[model samples]
Target: MIENVPEKAPEPITGPSVVVLDKQVPTVSDVQQEEARRQTKMDAAVAFAREKSDRVRKLAASQQSPFQGNSTGKVIIPNTKVGQGYDLFAPVDKKKMKVLFDWLKLDPDAFINILRLQYHKNPHHFRSGRIYFLDHVFSRIWRDKYPEFKSSEPDHNGCKKKAPWRGVDDIYAPVNFKNTHWIAIWILIPKKHIVIWDSIAKHISDEELAEVMEPDQWIIPYLLVECAGSGELCVQYTLKPFTYMRVTAGVSQCRAGDCGVFTLMYIECHALGMSFSPAFSSRNVKAIREKMAVDIFQEAPESHDKENNDNDENVTTYEQ
Candidate 1:
């Protein structure tokens, strides 16, 4: 019945076959699906970080405020009126406090003055006036010389103006470089070092930062000399060379908008002579922001109380 070939295997029945290749090429759909998965993972990670940050903020906000008295939570600084420029004693309304809420950017009034108040509160912890947080406008004055401080004048007029830098060991000045980023310029007068604290230092070149500070190196020393000569800038002025360096170590922010907060923290840590606490990272920044707002809002009256606490060794008046 069967030939030598046997009954031909019923002609091999096959539909459109998947020709298996050693390596299959990915289709556009495959690529798209893979990309979508990657994106979803990233979104999930970001959401988790944000959730953790929010929890920390809420917990800290619920704790008892260190400040005494029923917190009005109204005026940040009483008596002094707002819109009088960036005065250290200027009044800040609730709206300014709102900026410290929800990761909002801090204006000079909100941060610098709050810091001044905090430092002013615990004077025994820090040497009064030894650490000066200059107004953000200090940079502007440095760039566009004030008429009173014009180079042509050669002197601040023998009238003996107040030199805030008098007896200051560290000057934490916020420099808004190019109107884009906020950075801290820490001038250690004794160390003769101009240390830069920037959240995005890695993204910038040492050369660029040095260039931006070149003018300051000369102007600052000159100003110090001028003040020491005229006003109460009592630090030992050696006129020696000052070294400029950018801080590349420590916790840095993962986002761009956090530079303002980071700058404030840098000043705080350095002023306290403490290394950046683990609590000062990007995850805790929201908490830091909330605490700052609370400290500012509640401590509005602390300035007056501080002035009255002259006999209390734990507190001392910040004399300019």
Candidate 2:
């Protein structure tokens, strides 16, 4: 105790010592956190790709025809053989078939003609009545050249073939407006009313109606007078006035440039005597178009007889 030993050197004043290892090892929690972070990144990436794909699809859908690589693109129905005595309506050739392909507006020759043939062939499906089918051009031709053909004699204008509507209950015509819109006109002969199914408008102005509906109102009665030949049919239509009407079935086009398809469908439904249902809309219109094309092809006389040879020049493959 008397010996003054130097105060033991204070222990080295160092902070808590750090351990050194040959290789640092991660804890279980550290591994779990890293895996969760990786999974989050992958999910985010997948979501981003899905959004971009959806955007591209929507844009393509807006610009192109919905029926691009459908079943309709498989093969082309051959042209009717010459001198076959095949009285086919709306025979599909290379040109006419193209209407159903390539985002083109439905041409009158291909679409309405084939439909008329279908109506005639399957009478069971159609309403039992004397329904007269007029081509798409019939109304517009009369509209543009009304008085010019008023006195031209129905025979001269080939009205003889479409004549003798002794007991015609209805007349259906597909009409085009401004060469860009399609609508259906149903002349209810007994009702003396023209019901128009316009996919574009629910109701048009009276003035517009008067102007647009003039051809039908005037020419139909006149044709009746000429073709009916002073019979009861002629007298009835001549005496009474035809009124204009717009269908109130809540049927309107939900997509653009689909007016033609809507017009054709309206005529078909009325022809079948079926009520317009919500099932028919722009949603499944592309599928409808594909079916229509196939139907037209099968209706061709050559379709059943001919073999589809790839080497044959007449047999062209369908192009999108």
Candidate 3:
């Protein structure tokens, strides 16, 4: 075997052996294209579902609705029931009244005027006259109300500066004689603005009014007087720490007139920290209140007729 054995045949390479070492790398572009396709399919499904839902909702609303296309051309009016018997002057207890007076820091005359306005048989008669008197009263009360907060004090540099704790001085009263259903009063404070709403012929409690103010903070005393037959009155302070101010009644029905007194008051308070001066004179305020009242009462019949016609149109359109 050693002498003449044939050379062993080289074993042939068998089965699957690792010959070329090609790295099994995944292409990023291919993965991204696949993902993009999946996302596109998902988006299409979502859009289709949304369209189907909207169509179903529209169909359901069409079958059951009464005023589908009448919103643009009609003045809708709410029906008032005869003799629903709402009390215009709801009596307040002495304790509640006292709390209100303390909260507002009102003087005796101002307090009396508030009471008189609340109890008056005809609020419009006192609208102009009382507002002037109240303006003077408010000026005096505001001077006395914020003595500590308004006073200058020595700061870290030994120079006098206005105290950091300040209260809002702007007050707004929006009386709508034309719309005697409700009255709104606005008070702008350094920290926030408050709105008080009272039913024209109803009484609102002090507790309810307090709810309109920010909680857990010192609130500057303010008063809201609502004469259902006249207008709403608010006594507030100005940016000048101790200055008293007032805003007259505003009518919301007119597009130009609906400046959203409440919204403006809030914005001003938020931006400037609750201090503002009166923008209108007392006489102007009174005049506006009187004019609005006359307009409201005189327009009642026409308003009712317009409402009826609008309703008829709406019903007809919906039926069609």
Candidate 4:
């Protein structure tokens, strides 16, 4: 997610005789061109990742076996979408599905870039390693995906010797549930808050949101505690320490299929510190889908990703 980086200052012209020069200025068209280049590069990366994703899908579809969970082990959610919640995801929208699918297809770097783009815009505001990597976040490993070779893990297994959440700032999680719907979770460290946003409100209950996490792992408290070790073992240090919080922003998805888009918009708008309303969530979803279709996909650790996403924007933790 490295876009719009701060450019270096121009060096002074060195000579025996000094020449007075007027202050330089960039034109509006120049600024527009630069922005276009940045966006075009992003869109190109997104498009390329989509192609790779399509190929893998076609190959998988051609074969008899189920998808191998890509490289992140996201294979399938073990029939979470089939039970009573089936009706919630019913009356599916084809266009919305395509948008979600396109988003899932992004390669890891492309995905990270989307997150990086926000950080790049406001570096001073966000902690450097604050994002919490989740299973549903679309990503492709940089070492394999990028040609120049940027390695994320030390050993071949993509495992770092230590965990990356020692002093985290903010967190971003994109989640898929029961293989049906998508949701998002964001921890606002500056505000001392955790926000859970779900597109399908009626389908997901308040009680359900309260427990939307692994049996023994709770990420909200982890951010507050000191992680003793690194990588997968880090969770042992802070396993489900009691936590309590509430949803800062709770709203329903206006349309059936736009839940995913709303989840993403929540992230984008929140990252920008902008207020989001029902109108933003309901309309212009296709635009959001198209943008996501173009950027995707990061790598840190599998444990960091095993966490699920929920709504409420508040943790509302309890002692166990």
Tens digit of per-residue lDDT, candidate 1, span 1-320 = 85676565578757777776655788889899999999999999999997765552222243337773434433332433359576698686778666446333545435666667778878666544677777565566566543344334333433222333346678787877776788888887777789888888765676777767765665566556655763444346644457888877775654787788888888877777778877778898778887776665576534223233322332221121
- Model 3: number of clashes? 10
Query: What is the lDDT of every predicted structure here?
Result: 0.64, 0.64, 0.35, 0.50
User: Which tens-of-lDDT digit does each residue in 175-225 have in candidate 2?
Assistant: 877766777889987787899898777435557767788767765665566
Please give the distance, in angstroms, between residue 184's alpha carbon in candidate 2 and its true position after superposition. Answer: 0.7
- Candidate No. with top TM-score: 2
How much is 242 displaced in model 3, in angstroms? 38
Inter-residue clash pairs, candidate 1: none
True-structure RMSD for candidate 1: 22.3
lDDT of 2 at 29: 92
Off by over 4 Å in 3: 1-24, 51-116, 119-320
Ranking by TM-score: 2, 1, 4, 3
lDDT of 2 at 306: 32
- Summarize candidate 3's per-residue lDDT along 1-320 as a digit string, tens digits: 45886789889978887766456765789789989999999999999997765552223333444756444222232123358597779685779654543322221233223323332545354322222211222323333343443354534433232222222243443333222222334444432444443322223244533432222112232111111112232333222222222222331122222222222222223233333334422334334333433433344323222233322423332221
Assess candidate 1 and give its lDDT. 0.64
TM-score to true structure, per model:
0.54, 0.56, 0.18, 0.42
